[model samples]
Target: MTLPTTEDRDPQSIGLSAKPDEEVLAHILQRQIVALEAARDAMPQIAGAAAALHAAAASGGKIGYAGAGSAGLTALTDCLELPGTFGFPADRMRILYAGGAKNLMTLAGVHEDDSEAGFKDFQESGLGSRDVLIAVSASGTTPYTLSAVQAANDAGTETIGIANNADTPLLREATHAVLLKTPAEVIAGSTRLGAASAQKAALNMMSTLVALRLGHAVRGHMVNLVADNEKLRLRAQRILQDLTGCTPDDAAIALQNAGGRVKTAALMLLKNLDVDTADRTLALHDGNLRPFL
Candidate 1:
């Protein structure tokens, strides 16, 4: 039977099961390298997707993610961290996966083929023209994922598709598409090893670049991070100190006055403003630190 590229056998690992441990690991590592390379090759598409999402965010739109199985989890990783990492509002992020939330941990692959389920889920998300949806499927043919993309697009929401194959419906169904084109896995048909990696790398770059574009980061630091716990709170203090050359004691005071908000605290220290004034300035600049600094 003919198979997709991701399901094809890797000739180098013809006797993979009989190989020595070191040789097996080496083969897997090579696949990982190829996956990363595929991600790198898709940077132009990633940049376009990031810009589209940024524009949606500026227009008060939400970001949504849709996928199935490993792809779904990889997409979740990006959506879940936006609030903690870049201080994105939690209400503005949404995730839809095959089999729904109850089956999240089980990852029932059968649900991936249910196109109607995907469409129904997106309909319930209340997506609108201001929203952006990212649909992920390594093979670019997962019925559930493609259905979500179709539903979102029909609703006037821009959809970005990420897949590992060219000329696939998933790529053609979206407003913007990212193709990772990773090689087949050493263990034939096991896409989680290579395809998943490429999807993750592409998602990482796209989401991080979007956050940076939104002024959530400055000088390689997370200026808009939500410092909820001790570790992040300490990191916020260090960020303030790094940005303003303030002492630890002063940083701590600023953080407290800013209510554990990293960006506001940094602005308070750098601009020598009180908490109220710092907040007002940050709001005026859309929470960007570069203008105040």
Candidate 2:
């Protein structure tokens, strides 16, 4: 096995020649474009990871995310969005920051290099066969992330590694690996500049796709989105109105009785059916509105 690198890692600590104000501005703009382009190019990786995660979720498996440094925060953000946006089941999603629980919301850079700690974290948690573990590391060599991947693989869990560098050890160790090829940061080795942004974009796509597979979406609309805010409530009313051929006012009225259930509200008003009957009919149709039509 190739040994891990103990080379100087901090980009800021590296020999980056500072330029004049105009040159710095130009470099910043260039890096921004590169970062977005890198994100676009990394779509397939996210798609593959999402497909794997969605299948595991369907099979009653828990989804876990692990990462180090800024990538860890990205993993946490991605996992958190799944629940609030798609109503994902609680307790089935997990995110592990390398510094453990206390490191969240704080920058604890040293923890990124600790593989033993990472392995212990996984062992302490109840990882099992019906679980998928995803590790995010821009360099594809964070000792912490690699450790978690190895532990998860040892546990017979599906493992996905997300990294900016190609041909890294974590890639070979993981069940699946996504290589996001972004240009080196304008600020040198600072992956938080470009790599974190790309990782976040990929994760956003992955989680959203998984939600789609779980029936939280229909076509392009978020049919299962919770109407917990005024914006979403308006959206729900509009959806019911459009589907049932009713006035917005009428749809809003039906929505109240349907407990803000857009599908039930539309069917109740348009089919001239009660809430119970509408709900039962939707269930009978397997929740596909087109079939009901």
Candidate 3:
């Protein structure tokens, strides 16, 4: 059997260990650029996946992520940030990392081979037809990730597979396949280098597009962001100011009255609506500020 390109050694790195420090670092940086290009190549598939994810979220459905090792960490980073970044509900996101949190410190390679664990985790995640799952694997054949995608398919849940290899089971089975054809890793099978970069870039695009479609992002600002910190509170203020041309005091008052929700505050100021009416009107428009603006 032919090894996947991710496992194939790059001829350019034949003497990488003996190279000068600058040359070695330059090679690594160039490979990262290539990985990002791979993500750019998958824009169409990423857009489709984002559309599906947006549909699921709009319909009050959950989003799940499954992976192992480096891929799992990438997915976890994206999953955990959704709520704070876009005001997506934390309860609506599920993570199915192989070996769960107990093994996160080590991320044992053995866990990636545990197909049963993957299937069990997916079954217990409560993801159904209304939900969507994104599974990532460099080789596109990791047992744990593949099993989770298969289980999701069986449950009639939409799935987006992000893989570095071509024609693998994950890609063939997933509802939307995002193939990130990253170059072979400089360290051969160590996909954490280039493959992880491509996966992260692809996921970033997908999630950002979903946020834009949901109207959580407007004019490049994260309008629906959960301003739970001082920095974010300041950002919320700025967004209100930029969008409404309101004074700092007026923006602060609107933010307070609207419970720090940028969209609600914007509507309250822009439409001359009271706080209660603004909140209700924003909800009536499905939290989409574009309609009100």
Best candidate, lDDT:
3
Candidate 1 residue-wise lDDT, 46-70, digit = tens: 9999998899887779999999988
- Give the distance in Å from residue 230's predicted Cα in candidate 1 to where it truly belongs: 0.8
Local distance difference test, per candidate? 0.88, 0.77, 0.92
Q: Which residue pairs in model 3 clash with each other?
A: none
Winner of 1 and 3 under lDDT: 3
* Better candidate number, 2 or 3, judged by lDDT: 3
Q: What's the CA RMSD for each of the models?
A: 1.1, 4.2, 1.2
Put down candidate 2 lDDT per residue, 200-284, tens digits, no spaces. Answer: 8778778777766666665566666557689989998877766667898898888888887766776788788898998899887
Compute each candidate's TM-score over C-alphas.
0.97, 0.81, 0.97
Model 2 sits at a Cα RMSD from the real structure of 4.2
What does candidate 3 score on TM? 0.97
Candidate 3 residues 1-293, lDDT tens each?
76789999988888988989999999999988987899888889988999999999999999999999999999999999899998889999999999999999998999999999999999999999999999999889999999999999999999999999999999999999999999889899999899999899888898898888889999889999857678988999999999999999999889988888889899989989998898889888899998765
